[model samples]
Target: MAETLRNTLKAERERLDLTQAALAERVGVSRKTINTVENGVFVPSTILALKLATALDRPVEALFQLDDSGVSPKQDT
Candidate 1:
């Protein structure tokens, strides 16, 4: 079984009226980094995730979650 990583970074960032570039600056990353994460092309590191959560005034869990939809049940032999 496999788990997926999901996030609400764009929504939260927008709620705070922040542009991707602005949020990136706040979190010490590049705008492309933020875009990548928002678009699910990249997974941020623990430090980056925490920094984003803090900058957006949200908890880390609120920003990211483990999605189990990708999990598959074991098949009997």
Candidate 2:
């Protein structure tokens, strides 16, 4: 099985005019974590994902996507 993870964290936050610090405060994470997430350098855990979704007022699926592309090519195809 393969998975692809896509996040709209930065876009959504920007759309709402939220700074990374503000988002981190709302999500109970450090600003560095939010920065890492926005930069695609971190893949959040389920709990963190839920917190982000809650803070953004969006469903988890809207913020994250799991698809074939997330896996290695050997696993995906």
Candidate 3:
């Protein structure tokens, strides 16, 4: 069985030098929402995931992925 959502959200945000509040603002969500999502306490809806991908200029799969190997993909940039 594949794992549930795996997130590189915090890493991706940091790569862009963005704070949680900053990312939240871009995605129209609260900082706490970003925090929870980062900490794996919450799974974002598809819309929010797409918003994040758009704001970060990445494919949603890069930030949120599912893999049976339990391995996170390496950053392309």
Top of the candidates by TM-score: 1
- Per-residue CA lDDT of model 2 for 2-75, tens digit only, reads 34476889999998999999999998889999999877778899999999988889999898876565465665
lDDT of 1 by residue, 2-77 (tens): 5568999999999999999999999999999999999888989999999999999999999999786866677999
Order of all candidates by TM-score, from best down to worst?
1, 3, 2
lDDT per residue, candidate 3, 26-60, as tens digits?
99999999999998889899999999999999999
Q: Which stretches of candidate 3 lie over 4 Å from their true place?
A: 1-3, 67-77
Runs off by more than 4 Å, candidate 2: 1-4, 70-77
Each model's lDDT comes to: 0.93, 0.86, 0.92
The candidate 3 region of ten consecutive residues with least summed lDDT is 65-74
Pitting candidate 2 against candidate 3, the one with the higher lDDT is 3
lDDT of 3: 0.92
Which order, best to worst by lDDT?
A: 1, 3, 2
TM-score list, all predictions: 0.86, 0.79, 0.82
**TM-score (C-alpha) between model 3 and the true structure:** 0.82
